[model samples]
Target: MSLTISELQALFFGLFGGLALFLYGMRKMTEALKATAGSRLKNLLAALTRNRFTGLAAGTVITALIQSSSITSVLVVGFITAGLLSFSQAIGVIIGANVGTTVTAQIIAFNIAEYALLLIALGFLLEVAGRREWLRHYGMVLMGLGFIFFGMELMSEATRPLRDYPPFIDLLRQTRHPLIGILAGALFTTLVQSSSATTGIVIVLSGQGFISLDAGIALIFGANVGTCVTAMLSAIGRPREALKAAVAHVLFNLGGVLLWVWFIPNFAQFISSLSPAHPRVDGCSAAGRRNASADRQRAYFFNIGNALLFIGFTPQLARLVDWLVPARAELDQPVQPKYLDPYFLSDPTVALDQVRLELLHLGQRTLAMVEEGLNAVTRGGRQRLNELRKQDEAIDTLHGEIVTYLGRLSLQNLVEPQPRQIYEYLAVGSYLENIGDVVETNWVTDGFKRLESGVNISTSTLRLLERLHEQVCRSGKITLEALEHNDLEQAREVLRSKATYNELAEQARTHLARRLVVVAPSRLDAFRIEMDLIDHFKRIHTLFRRIARLIEVSVSDSRKTSKSG
Candidate 1:
């Protein structure tokens, strides 16, 4: 018997519509989970990954909570690019992400379609009526869960009529060939961009006795391979470290699938033994609760086995990935924002973190310029001053880029503290830019004027100036370090050293003031240049102090928020 036109319409609409609901629900659930977790997830990954085992555990917990291995992989890539996580450490996380994704299969395996509507109704009520934001987030989670099960129910019903259709049954029988099943599963998952969807569909088919246990096992294995595409796509145009991480994901998944492809029957039988037996119904032994259980057990065993096999060889895997994805030389080019990935803009927490990293990069560049400014002024000629000016230009360019990036970020739906944080980052960027301007416009011009006037500073006065310059540079370095690490203590140190810097500036001024009475050619000019340099150093130190205060406020706010939560 063949499916009639009316029956075919029902099948097509039911399957496609159900899939749409499933995918939408997964997306909503992931989004809600991410919102609830927020920056804490980033902090967790940073804090927990002391070694490969801890990193694996972090990866598993994070992926299980978010319900998306792709998000976990992207986070790993971001951390690697930010230099927060090493490539070797990220390899373990990547492996554990695969293991974590099996949780979705386990979830869908529970026979709860009958209650999906109830869940949807309750979740809707809570989402609309809840008084707290977290409550709303949980409501969304419940709604998403309901949609997933309801979708599975629709898919199951859609396929029920196919049981009597000989041609469709013949097509499904071809999946009993492991290679074909793997190809089919991989291709479908790659197109849909959700291995969970493919897994859900395979479970639905098994529940209706449309595919054998071996076929379902092979398809699940293919899902492990197909899901790597998300990581690969995210790595496009990203740093070499990100590319290496994505490559590691592909190697681990594909290698595991190849290792286990030939043993599908044994894998299925083994998982079947682990799963509870379900009685045959309508002459289909695989048509009851055991169908989903067996499929989920297979996924669990496969991913866990792969993780165990690969965890010991992370160093080797990292080396192999490094070899495959070699670093690009242009990645070291100056004046470009390294951490401001547009992909992160969708998640404001991540986007803000990227901004913070970029600010650190900006601070480092500005600090180098400050260190070189004094050298260009006192010892070097016009060419050296011009080189220092070019450094200022780079600083200006980067500051502008940061401002523009922040502008874009402001357009996002920012939550509490993010708006304030953006303003603080903007202030810091402006202060750093002002420091560059002082060096370029005032200090460098004074150097040029002093060079043209044939005025030379006495060795003692130069030494005093150099000491003040050294103190300013020290403060700048400390401030940048504080910003990089978010260390409140370092920010406080910069704030506390303000009086010392002021005293040094006063001593430099008095020393330059004394030189005004000396009788020498261009003596007055020398006094003026030295005095101006002292004032510029003081101004730069003041700017550094301003940045330190901003860091202090930002860090304090973060601690308060963490505590409140």
Candidate 2:
């Protein structure tokens, strides 16, 4: 078991150097894929539904592309918190994430270590000299693949000496005990913060003749259990719904591990049957053949374990999580965007979705503020007037946050239509804020000033203003609806209704002017009050028109981009 200082240094170099390279490769590959496919992935995730099968498929696709279940789980938690996904649907995606993660093990099992240098050279040439964007991204992927295999090869060589080391052999034997093996797997994955890395390392060890099939399967079980740590840490301080999603992830993995712990022997036997030459058999002569079988068996073991857990426990797990985490009481909560998760900003498409949701919330809040201001004007309630003014502060805060977040997203080299979409969101946010200011500053303050001047609006003038208020409220609702649904037809309707609204305002103004002439000379200030209020309503209408127009332009851009793409 004794080793020279040089030997110890080599071991450390091989293990740590290979691990660092592997992690770096994984990150680069995932980031490149995400940059290339960000929008498609965003759309797929955004379209997640209550159907378990659909969620499962979406989860698998996303995780497979990104090469990290942790990222997928973080996304699922954020979506759940934002109300984009239900607890039940998130469970299916989680299952798919587990299944998708197994793809890494499968890829590693190919044992293409000898070709690593060739891939590295090709990848470097394309990455450094390619003229196209796709060429560079694909080159990055190639480079990452090369680094991964090269690192695995190094680690395999480094650990080969362990086959003869007595102490190391004793430690590998302890892994034959399921509990000991699972604990080792969990502990190592927790430290690495990646199940795939831990699993890959175990496969490398297995291929090097340092671990048996049953021991490898036990370690795989532990890796699954340990990966939950990432999701749990992400959920801290997040919304209650997000916390529940994290809990469900932990629960699902733990339950599956416990259920499968007693059956590792049976599962290992089944995996061996599927292999060309069982690990227990002595007929296999080629080192490559033996290593390939071991690696493939480990991969299959990981995949099948997840498949069975998801298939058998999805329904029960869904129900159990729901019962465990009930919805919070929805009281008279203030109007705000429930789903504006800043974590989504990493993906511009998802971040844009968050902005859209936040803008919708801003619109809803603005509408409420307008309604209260109108009530104050019509009913002359001082308290209601103050409440509307206070609500504007919230509108301002949300507006600023949306703008800042979009600005951050814009800094990233976004894909087609995204830069245009950022401008649209900014325009919509500005318009929404203007509407709030109109209600609080223009309407309420002006009404108070008119009152201080001893001017009381005539009954006829009040009725006209009420009708105009109704029109403005309707316009706000329509604009919000069009934006939320991204309905081109609805946006067109909003555009067409502008003339009708103008006509209505013109008729009301003319009628008000005539009424002003008939008002007593002592009430001359009433004329100014009524006229100013009408002008304010017109300004509000103009802002809504701007929002509706932005919506229209965004939809058009989206169509053009889709066609071109």
Candidate 3:
């Protein structure tokens, strides 16, 4: 039988449009769910992925609620960024997403087409009639459900002629060729971009009895590989850790495809022998073609089987990904803020302006480290020190940023006035950062070791110190604001509070010092802990002084401006 171009055109448009509708609906549903879920989706991964079991359960429920595995995976990346879950913990979540995604297949398989219009009307009502997030959620769910069902029905109707078209059947026959079939499936899913949609089409075609089990399984395999593309796209501008997550997704799916390709015949027999029914292909008559419908059901099973096969290896697979793209090593040095140049200033004047900005940025970084150190001694079971190192890195990054900006500025031929202003800013930035170092130097790295090696602060003393820490943080904030805005009034208040907090903080030390000398037993560790908290408050006071100085300089500058004016 000769094939007409119009028949091919009809088939192409139908498939393309069906796939488009499926993908578009998936995107809308994903964004709406994420928006509605807000930070709760983010917090879920953080609290949930502590262990593989929890991770899996969380992933399943979250993915099911979100209705898109891609959204679930991206949320995992956010959790990782927030330091909520480690890369390893993310593995089970990804694996669970596979199972969660099957909800789409199950939903699509239901005969909701008859109710699509009614469902859409209800969805519109919910959308127009509600201030509640749950109602909005229900509205989005209804809309997605309506769209998916309607699109599937349109696809089925449009492709009805393919059942009788010898040429169309001949093309579908290529699905029996594992490479050709897998490639076709992968390409279609990649282009249409939803494994669920691809799998849904397989169900519809199988139910129609137009494609055999062997063809369906090959496409299912292809759909698995195709799913990774979205993750890969997300990794474009992200850090290496993010890239690894996407890579893990790819490697996990690709490995499954490779394993199944070798055992294709065995897998095919398993899927086909089950003869799971495809209700779509049974459109002609539910009583006829039970075997073909079974083959289609097996097609879906093929996807699940492969995902199950890989889920076991998710942890082991994470290790492989780690080997391929190792976690970036922890930086050993205190990074200067100068290293973090915005690098935006290409012109001499602009570069100088950037240098000044970096100087401020650098000061801010040091201020953060000082802030964290204040908490480390005062807060119980201070988080892993390395975790607090981000505060230090923030300082170092700014130092590097400023230095780089300065170097670029120095290379340029600056005018008389700007050069002095740039130099003064650089000098001020360096001085402020030195204060940051003084604060850093006060951090008892060994002290924490000596303390946690089991030194206990008395309950009364601990409570007093906690209150002191609170007061010190206030002083720090006040000082920082004063300096940042050059507010002399805030600066004086910061200094006054610093003196008051220091006197109180110092009194605790004096009591410790006297106890050590008289009635105290030589629990030198306890003494050190008391002194550490005392010193923490001391550094807080010092940060305030520096900020006060910044305010003083700014005030003097204003006076000079007044004189010039």
Q: Which candidate is the best by TM-score?
A: 1
Estimate the TM-score of every prediction. 0.92, 0.92, 0.59
Give a tens-digit lDDT track for model 3, residues 205-286: 7656666656667777888778777668766765566678788778767877887787766765665555454233322344
Q: Rate the local accuracy (lDDT) of all candidates.
A: 0.86, 0.78, 0.65
In candidate 2, clashing pairs total 0
Clashing pairs in 1: none
lDDT of 2 by residue, 1-565 (tens): 6777888899989988998888877877877777777677757877864588778778888988888776676677667655777777788888788778777887878878999888888889988999877788888888889888888888888876666787887777888899998999999988988887887798778777777777888888888778788778877776666667778778867877888889888877777777777655211123423655655556445555665657556678778877877778899965456666656666666667778888998899998888777668656767777877779988998888887788788887576668878888898999999999888888888768665776667677678788888888888889899998898877787778778778878887898778766847546677776778889989998898888888888888878878976
Give lDDT tens digits, candidate 1, residues 395-421: 899899989999999997666677898
Better of 2 and 3 by lDDT: 2
Off by over 4 Å in 2: 45-50, 74-85, 128-131, 281-289, 302-306, 309-313, 326-337, 407-413, 519-522
Q: Provide the lowest-lDDT 10-residue window in model 1.
A: 278-287
So what's the TM-score on candidate 2? 0.92
